[model samples]
Target chain A: MKLLTYFFQWLMSLLWVVALQAQAQPTQPYSYPPSEVVRIHSKILNEERKVYVHCPKVDSADGNKRFPVVYVLDGDNHFELLAQYIDYLSRPDVLAIPKIIVIGISNTKRTRDLTPTNSLLNYEGKPDSSSYQGSGGNEHFLQFMATELMPMIDKNYKTAPYKIFAGHSFGGLSSLNCLLTHPDLFDAYIAVSPSLWWDKEYLLKMTDEKLKHGSALNKMLFFSDGNEGGRNSFFHKSLVKLEATLAKKKLKRLDYRYKHYPTETHMTEPVVAYFDALRFIFKDWEKQR
Target chain B: MKLLTYFFQWLMSLLWVVALQAQAQPTQPYSYPPSEVVRIHSKILNEERKVYVHCPKVDSADGNKRFPVVYVLDGDNHFELLAQYIDYLSRPDVLAIPKIIVIGISNTKRTRDLTPTNSLLNYEGKPDSSSYQGSGGNEHFLQFMATELMPMIDKNYKTAPYKIFAGHSFGGLSSLNCLLTHPDLFDAYIAVSPSLWWDKEYLLKMTDEKLKHGSALNKMLFFSDGNEGGRNSFFHKSLVKLEATLAKKKLKRLDYRYKHYPTETHMTEPVVAYFDALRFIFKDWEKQR
Candidate 1:
């Protein structure tokens, strides 16, 4: 009986020591791709805007090197995802793309700033005044990006001349809008599931008007759609029309690709589309290197 | 001159205020999915092990709910990526998959812990002594996982009975090895580019011997190969053989998928294969609900 009690006591002490060691072992937060939030007061918008900036970890030898930037809209939704892709693709082992900076712009007035024309029509072609109350500010938004945001980013960071604009849904519409209105603002454009039905296809008509046949518009573009409604849906039809229009124009140096994901839904489409878009943009990049 | 001086002073004051405001605007680290590192002393492996744990954010309504677990090998390389995918896929907005816990097992001894046999020959059939010094301790490692790690996770976190084992490359070989040797260890297995050429195709032969024709092995498996070598390469050929063997077996209730990504390299394959595997495993999930 005495031996049994002694064995029990020994076991208890061992358990206590093991527990203490487990607690004492050093642990740290799972560090993700290093990213930061920067705040800037925008004069054009008359509001404070916050953006998430993710830059690749620089080598000591390449501290002064500049990197191309990808300005992503819907920052709150897709910044970290883009950041993760950028980091992984540009890793030492996987040199699929060059190390680039990702600037994610968060929204204060998403609808107002993303829509090209003021209209209250919902996706079902019905009036939705509550959701579309303060629309048609995308032009001003572009001006702010071109003049204020771009200049600020260039001045503060080691930025290269090359830049890419990326967005999804309404944000995607804005990206295409920027390409048409302010072509020199970015070198590449990604519009995933863009709301081409916005204001009765305002951006689609704008694309036709702005991009001329045989015009020397050197840029890369990737646009895609998932199963928002299906093949006959306005979403899919608009994408097909956009593709056809671009092909008909045969504009010089406008490299573009359109992908359709039938299995994915609208919200889950960006997860795959963004990765594909990045791969498309950088497809020729590895060969050039 | 007096008016100019006054205007200059006003402009200077405004600039100073703007600078101060920029400095004062609250900035915080980009918050990632909350994750933690756990240290465990494994008596089976006779060493300490570190695992990464990433759980979905618990809603107030789901305080007592349990989650399925995915145990991923190569914690250092792919944990963050999988965590990101799970968080995005299981979001309230994007209900592509259910919320689950991810356990990433970090490697202490890579070759010994991951390989199934003691072999000095690499993919090229060349003897590499240093690299294969301590090969073939995977059985003990799996024991550590089943006896030590899973129990600890179950005791600490709200875990469901459904479990998945995921790995890549050599880790992928171990995943297949576990499936063939200890079929009841996990409900699902994901082997992304398993090095089937290991020990002159030991696991491939083991699969032939262990799994009987039309056997009732109720499990899900996803395996794939990327551009490790071209289509005619041994890597691709071995995958073809494995698929043929499985097909010939006609194992009952063993849901399996084989994907080939010709565009992606061996290293880059995991990025796409994992997403596809998750989708495949949960393909019928929505309809069941």
Candidate 2:
């Protein structure tokens, strides 16, 4: 009986030690909601494109629910950020925005596809032939997006009709270009620090020509610029001119806002601009929904 | 030979179909860097505290490097956001800030631990028994953080001496409480729309009493208030009074800034306030580093 009691005591001590150690060990690393990488062969661009898709977790209450989709450019740079924002803002506590699908279209040939015109002229309006070579393929890229990528996303995901296109820098230029050329493609567009100095301000001119006076756009557009050079720089000047042009057009139902982050740098602007743009785009979403 | 050719053609056709189907399927879901749930048995709190710890991916060059830590309250709400921010800001392309560890302290009893005073009075200076039942354990909570949590983190992770404490609302109340009482705990403090109205404007009163005339704090603090009840509300008034008190102190080496987000609400404030606070705290870090 004495031996048995000692044995039980030892066993109890061992279990206690094990429990204490187990409590100290952390649980498995927590993971963010997974985003998938989708591969599609584009007939228009004649390239195999890889895109990142982030979908929301659906509850039983969200039965047969279709989500709005935000297609962002420069997938490698900004996909995760947008995905994070969409998830957070759409949480049950924060119904600031609805649960939306984020489709980040990764680049194949960034320079060739993002620029709207073929020109050697740089931001300084000087020739830089090597950099500007094969630059005017944006139309083909847009066709690829319109005919190939969008269809693929809509076919695969539980998608709503409301679509948004977002981008930055060259990607920002591409976003604005799409807004001007294929305004019907997306319901909203975000252009963060668009390289408005591209090809002798080609898109700025296009924006003026395409947006007819007193016309109905029925879309939301949020564009902004950072202090790229200074107040006197071409980058700032172009954004001001674009804003002025939009004002001049007096396009009815073209819900748009141009924000200038004077305190931010070109590189650092996107972190804040993207959040602000989302808020501006979906300001009335909660009440409307 | 003809039979063999027919077999080869059939194989090729089969292969093509298989490849197309394979391409249509999405690649594995892209994952954000994971954060672990660390359970620490706090003798003071008499319960297990779960903290979300997000560590940066260390490369060969960073083999022996240590990182500063930011301890944020309301882990469940804001942990992911801070993790996302740290990852983006510290990227090679961004590099606005350095790689840092984020420790988000999830709540067990939020009200009991966050409030500084034992009072039944609510934000409106009226008695509310049910809501303020177990308030005024902040000092004990701070003690738990200082004695139990910080040591465990230091022991397990590669930690730098510099630390930051961030909180919002009631959590913000705790942060300011810590700053006033245990000033040595953190290098920086961020209070986003702090509940200065707690206990009939208790913290606002405490702030004035704590800072000695021309005292050297040698710390950084970023405090902001949103349009939480409008310009005439006590929320705005309390923040203004706090700022005025800090200014009157004229404490030496206390690098602080007060930002007012007239556009943001109490709940939506953290989204922008946190970003702005981070920028303010790390404004001189790049140059200094």
Give the DockQ (2 decimals) of all models: 0.27, 0.33
Is model 1 an incorrect, acceptable, medium or high docking prediction?
Answer: acceptable
What are the TM-scores, per candidate, against the unseen true structure?
0.90, 0.91
Find the candidate with the highest DockQ and give its number.
Answer: 2
| Model 2 regions more than 4 Å off | A1-27, A287-289, B1-25
For the second chain, the TM-scores of the candidates in order are 0.91, 0.90
Cα misplacement distance, residue A210 of candidate 1 (Å): 1.1
Question: B234, model 2: CA deviation in Å?
Answer: 1.0
**Distance from true location, Cα of B272 in model 1, Å:** 1.2
In the range B45-68, model 2's lDDT, one tens digit per residue, is: 999999999999888979799999
Q: In model 1, state the lDDT of residue A192.
A: 97
Provide the lowest-lDDT 10-residue window in model 1 chain B: B1-10
Candidate 1's DockQ:
0.27
